[model samples]
Target: MSRLLSLSFFVLGALAQGTSPSYDYIIAGAGPAGIIVAERLAEAGVSVLLLERGNASTYASGGRSLVPWNITLTQYDVPGVRHYIKNSFADKSEYCTDTPGNAGCILGGGTMVNQLAYIPPQNVDFDDKWPVGWKWTDVASAAERVHSLNPGSTNPSADGVHYDQTSYNAFANFFSAQGYTSVDAISEPNSKHDVYSHAPYNVKNGLVAGPVMTYLPMAQAMSNFKLQLHTKVIRAVRNGSTVTGVEVEVDGQRQIISLNNGGRVILASGVFSTPRILFNSGIGPNEQLQIVAGSKATTNVTLPASSDWINLPVGQGIKDHIIVTLNFNTTESVDFLDTSYFIKPSSNITDPYSHGNGILTQGYQRFTFWTSNTTSDGSVRYFQGTCYASGQNYVSMKLYLTHGLTSSGALGITAAGNTVYTVDPYLNTAEDKYAIASFIDNLLVQTRKADSTLIYSGPSTDTGASLSKVYTGGSHWVATAKMGTDDGRVNNGTSVVDLNLKVYGTDNLFVVDASMHPDLPTGNLQATVQVAAEAAAVKILALPKQQSLSSSSSSSSSATSSISTSSSSTSQLSSVSTTSSTSAQLSSSASSTLVTLTTSASTSSTSSSTSSTSSTNTAQATNPTCPKSDGTTFTAKSGAVFLVECYVDRVGHDIAYVDVPTNRIADCVNKCDALPGCVDISMSGTACYMKGVVGEKIVNSKYIRGARRIS
Candidate 1:
């Protein structure tokens, strides 16, 4: 039977008699992606178990860190006091203890405790290095789905007012005079070059809003879905390449929750925790696997044998955006909001909180701007500056070297199973140092030009080691389990997961969180992370159930011994369909939900173009056969033409590849044009290899090459 049909039956059976302890999809971590993916899968009429290591956060989730003045709401529900939850001193309940760096462990994870800055990703963020199906054009609709629900507000107060104009005016004048266009940053996401705007946050009418508010509630209402809080997933139980289930810790007792016939396990536990889980499951570099085996505190738990270890670079290339702040004494009069606001709102703020409209609703930072610089080596480095009231008559701009930074660090698991950053991804490289110093020098020049009264309060020299030492981490970790076409199980391969978000060399094991991102995005990660999850769900749902469950039956043989014998009574079915026995049952529900719940915007289709050249290319593909082994020329929508070569393979300089549908030649041309630095493409059947520098070309009949006709 098909996996979908089997899972549907399991759900119906469980609802009637409560027979199986297995689930169709077991998602680890209750972050934005985890919630979104679980909701979509459950809406498809399949059983899903969403697990979170931490307890409830935010009042909706049972978090009761109530605001001192108002007894009804918690600090997590308030937009202004987001910093309170982030600081360990104020509240460490949401903090992840296993990871050395800061990470949220609560329900909704980072989304629940974040600054709520909802900066939409720039188009170049996807078009630059992401794989084909994840390109800007492909995922634009998915991003729109998130934006439509969480349309970030510039004026968050219910009264529709920019409460504090003192800091906004000071910085706005500085940036506007420097020729930076003042825009709604969230609306014009691509305007990252020279723009200044009021900080846009994922807030609505003075309340914090995110996936917890939007996606999680829909999932909670579904009968096929069950959210298990405080259930910590220790590691995946796998029989060689097939993952059967995850061994979770509930109330200090280890238990295995097996997958149904075709169930899948998706790890969305951020960058650090995802890698740690993989390592514990013996699915990482030999050194890490050895550490996991050697570090076990108890012999009761059985781990995957050494011979079955999947040696991949799981914790390599971990990244975080390095932040550097500059304190300036501005002549403009502005006072910082006092910390006492957390205990009791000031007389000026009390009226606004009562009316749900005031200065208290605004984010700590008021104005934000973005800039970029091209180094001598021709690499562009991106920078973002956020201005906030630091003190009386003082403002601090926290400058972030957001995108295009070459430096990266590593994450590793210690003998005690603690995850820590082995190397800090800061200005460790000379190139990064030069880029940061150059950006600061240029920024100082601009500050002087924009406002003579804006005086630098820090070091006289803001260029070298002195400046670099003052940098803090942005805490936006990503790429610990990097995603790409290259399978990491092979020698010298760097990718941990494939284009489908499935972990390489493993069946039914995937990652759908920040860990799957190949690199850091251009802005705050929440918006982009949510969009990627939506796109990933679409791709995962398109796959056949049998293909996903190829080794499910055989893997069960090894799973029985380590699997939990006790069945969990924690899940409660609400409104599951009792007679969902056909495979079409899942698809029918999934299609309707994808259109309405997941994808709010109309899907972008490529067949609408009227280019005669594309029509000619498609005419050749009418036979349903692969294109000619060799070719001559083609044209893209950008009016750029390409010279095609047959039987040639790209040796290096591979940015990413596109899996084209009908017109392989025409689709390759369009994909190359969409990618930023794609100079050439090597087409191999359905796969079109997009190249950045076009290093070395060799003859291989399995593929054809297309080099752009650079005028």
Candidate 2:
């Protein structure tokens, strides 16, 4: 009813304000963080004006709701004799080519149609990498706010389950047998420690229930808030410390998108888009302005004194998780591969989203990571998210360098236009590259250990092939609007926003999104970025008019008093009650041993928190183990179906299976019959991983690829 009435009101309002819709606050992009900030401010009784480049129906895909990738993919790029469809993340949204950098020109930014998985970085990360005056406590509060503001935005299965829990448990157990530990986590902001599982979604029943559905809706309801779609903000109207409003494009016509001088302005545009906005306004790295615009420094938008020229690093230390995965298929018998995850996955409904679950829900043809691996792990070293299409469901194992060093990427405007950014992400650092290579090696090794022949491998598909410069740079990009001690390189190190999140030279203007993260975390960037936005908002609202702008001013008396009003009071949308998963029935002796295995597991930094610790039921040491199926040990065999495998539970899980290393798809199905429990498979090369609970010993079976089960 509310949805319908809101629709009617919007129509009437559009008829009324079609000529000119005024607003108090204007935000740039409509991605996850951008939507969050807009919603937060609007709720506080402030008029918010959001300018979105895409149309509203962007989130709706007719009645089908199927993203573009959901339909086409299989039509092309498959393995074998012909028509091999191998569309990696390269064809997803952002459509970044070898050169042309395009930001999502649609509403909801990336969130309207991203994997939509939400996570929070570990406590230690905020405590260490983020700037002074910000810590785990501050961030935790923010995460809580975002989730509370938008809770359970996902679809649960027809049954009670959310994802493929059995498969996840099977593989997770295998890791435990190898002496790994499990982390016990919760979705609430209670600050508990646990290995996180399927994070709650903002998708309600096959819908992309993100900013467009939640924050944006609430903000739109307020008479104080106004949203304008199909509009692009060119730059902020500035006259020193004061932002008059914005210059925007509406109906392909340029117009002055005004905001009250007293009302604020926010750069909610994403990382790529935000910096461009700043640069166009003559507020970025000087060298960038000169090179891109061929300008001798033209626009005088009122910057502070020359001494205030912060020689701070901006858009440096860019990083992302590198991924590697394999797959397998046989017949029907738990064919949860193509669709249908755990109908009763043994996880909490309030679980925070992550990768290790038996099957992934948040990732459309994707998977989550953190994977209890390296600490100070690999980071975004100048890689961009390329696209094969706007959207698709694919599998990938994202890897993070818990720590990043020795390399940096700069986001500079190129003379070509705002569309082309100088993507000089240096990925050849010996240490960083090698570390990436090693991580890739670990992925192959881990997957293979679960099922020997689970991948498409050959002369073309080697461990080194996974390290192809063409492979990755996940969505997680960070350190652009960074913090820390002022560095003279990469422009000014003196951050754009201070500890309280207020812009250094200006008053009221604030940057409360992923751009403010000083250091990239070890894993996905969404959770951490959102948390930063949360914390920034808390501080922003607490700021007194006079106290916020002064860098030297201590906390204001009024502001402090306001802060004291209610430390526990927050304006979050709602709260999610986390239910602890019923503990596994371990033998008393096994439980005692398990305690030691889990408690002693170490935690790494530079990534989001969630330790799926590998624990051993040493006492029972009799963890469920798989018996090798192929009579013979897995060897690099020819003309045979090989399975590349990994342990999800104690049992083996195939990454992918294939028929011929000789490069032929002739006998794919017959190969599966030769191996036991080989349910289904996806062939890439000669590597073929079985799809069942294959044992600890990865089997390399010998069979031909002829026919597969169509059923």
lDDT of 2 by residue, 298-319 (tens): 3222333344333334444544
Give the Å error, residue 43, model 2. 2.5
Kindly report which residue pairs in candidate 1 clash with one another: 647-700
**Model 1, poorest ten-residue lDDT window?**
563-572
- For model 1, residues 1-711, the per-residue Cα lDDT tens digits are 111322342234234322348877899999988988886665444667888999667654556665665544567766777765555235668889889677789888888767777788998888877887788877764665566456677788777888767878888877776788898888789999889889988776456777766566555544556778778888999988888899998889988998886779999998889998998888888987777788777423356988888888898888778888887878778767666665456666655554567776677779989988887778888888878887887888888888888788888888878887777777787877888877777667655554455677765656544676788988787888999987888868889999989998888899999998987787888888899987787677666663433232222221111100001100101111212133312222221111111111111111232112222333232211212313435556776766555334545576875555332466676778889988887653234667787656533322133554453
Off by over 4 Å in 1: 1-20, 86-90, 298-301, 446-451, 547-711
TM-scores of the candidates in the order shown: 0.74, 0.59
Q: Each prediction's Cα lDDT score?
A: 0.69, 0.42
Name the candidate that leads on lDDT: 1
TM-score of 1: 0.74
Model 2 lDDT on a 0 to 1 scale: 0.42
- In model 2, the worst 10-residue window by lDDT is 592-601
- Model 1 CA RMSD to the hidden true structure, in angstroms: 13.5
